[model samples]
Target: MIRLTGITKQYATKGGMREILKGIDLTIKPGDHVGILGRNGAGKSTLVRVIGGAEPPSSGTVERSMSVSWPLAFTGGFHSRLTGIDNLRFICRIYGVNFDERLAFVKDFSELGSYLYEPVGVYSSGMRARLAFAISMTIDFDCYLIDEVMAVGDDSFRERCKVELFEKRKEKAMLIVSHSHRYLKGTCNRFLLFRDGAITEYEDFEEVYAEYKLLLEEPQKF
Candidate 1:
């Protein structure tokens, strides 16, 4: 089980001090699939970062029963000048794992083909996302924290992602961030809406999604 208690995150904006998360409390059991939704600057990314341990919350605690996967994005840790193959080996070295097996998996799953030998700095954003997803999947984790990575995949890869992530990995907990309602509804079993520096859990995704859409349509009211 993953439990977050009294979590609060504050940021210093030019205008004034802004509270991103105000006393968030949530529990995610094993096998839970959760989608996090919010408008821009609503602190959805911040919440995911805090839970991923990339940033510490201003207050409160996040408790987890199992190891959590890092955010699925190639922008972090990956050296731009390094080739994908080299980076794969590098990541394996960091984890002290045998790269021979997992490296092949990442190579094949990324579908970069011969391009995997090229430096990542020359790769497009879509290519970077694919490599990130491939590496993350090859790594073993009890829970996953994703942020906008799903949107970068192509149609076929997206379908494969649905099968592997939502179907095969149903036993693991997941917290995904995406603006695509179709993707969210198709994968997540529950929803969490972030707004006004707070987080709210909902059983009905459509209801919370509607409220979020309203907030977007009328930003002045929110």
Candidate 2:
């Protein structure tokens, strides 16, 4: 289970301190599929970062009893100077997983072949995304944090990714934030609408989508 209490995030601006997240409280349990909806810069990603421990909350606590993954398939954390296999070893060390045992899986899944021996700086964006996503699957996380990364590649690759994440990991918890309401409608059971730095939780899809559409049509009013 994961519990966020009084979560708030603030950033320094020329004018003054600007708050992004506003004393939000949330709980995520096993098999909970949560979909987050909000306009750009409305603190949807900010909340995900706070919950995933990528960034700290200004005035709140995040408690986690289960293993929570960082935003799925995030590629920015890799060291450009390091080889793909080197970064894999580093990640495995940090996560206390067996590097040797996981090597075959990553190698086959990423389909990087000999490219894994080359520096990450030389890899293309698509290659890097494939490597990162394969490594993500190496760890058995209790909950996955997904920030608009619905799919990563061509038709067949995307289908494989869907099967691996949504089908194989269906029993696990997921927190998804996406602009595509259709994807969220199919993937999540619980919904959260972010407005004015606050969260409104709902279970019924109709209720959440109705409000989301209203916010979309009149974003300034909300």
The number of clashing residue pairs in each candidate reads: 0, 0
Off by over 4 Å in 1: 220-222
**Top model number, lDDT:** 2
Q: What would you estimate as the lDDT of candidate 1?
A: 0.84
Q: What is the lDDT of residue 132 in candidate 1?
A: 81
Worst 10 residues of 1 by lDDT: 213-222
lDDT string for model 1 (79-107, tens) is 89999888888888988888889878887
How many angstroms is residue 171 displaced in model 2 relative to the true structure, after the best TM-score fit? 1.0
TM-score of 1: 0.93
Clashing pairs in 2: none
